[model samples]
Target: EAGVAQSPRYKIIEKRQSVAFWCNPISGHATLYWYQQILGQGPKLLIQFQNNGVVDDSQLPKDRFSAERLKGVDSTLKIQPAKLEDSAVYLCASTGTSGVHEQYFGPGTRLTVT
Candidate 1:
């Protein structure tokens, strides 16, 4: 069984630029999530999706951050007019809702806002 998948392991851009990340979850997983991890801090949930529908995104910055799960499978996260504070790692995870919600994380995309 494969874990989650993410693209562009690393990225660097000047502040105010836009950036996007991609993710593909493991097969059979029913839920997917996007998280932002700042250095020295635990990951913060940015959004969650159950199949192709959005389940949660209250923590996501509506001004510049957006995400979507397509056909209940692949997902994408985008940040426009990114600020310097947006420099962090974007992680993707997936899990089944059968009893445990133990999520499997992907190799995250590291974004550097200069």
Candidate 2:
């Protein structure tokens, strides 16, 4: 099976700028997730989607961050008016089904807010 795909492996922006990242998960995977990994810390779950419906987003910074999986396949995450503290790696991951515990992650998009 092919791995999850993400675009623009790196991004650099100034404070209060806007940026977006895209992800294409493995075929047939029903669950998708986004995570933020700050330097020196483990990845933190940002949001999760089951098909086109959001399963969880309690950790997401909704004031400036948003995400969508409109077709249940591809997803996009956007941050508007980004902050310097937002510098981190944004990771996309997917799993086969509700019962599946193993998640395959994409090569994350690294963001640097200057």
Tell me each candidate's TM-score.
0.96, 0.97
Error of 1 at 86 (Å): 0.4
* lDDT scores in order: 0.94, 0.97
Strongest candidate by lDDT: 2
Which ranges in model 2 have alpha carbons more than 4 Å from their true place? none
What does the lDDT read for residue 60 in candidate 2? Answer: 97
21: Cα error in model 1, Å: 0.2
Model 1 quality (TM-score) = 0.96
lDDT of 1 at 75: 95
Q: In model 2, what is the error at residue 55, expressed in angstroms?
A: 0.5
Candidates in order: C-alpha RMSD to true structure: 0.9, 0.8
Which is the leading candidate under TM-score?
2
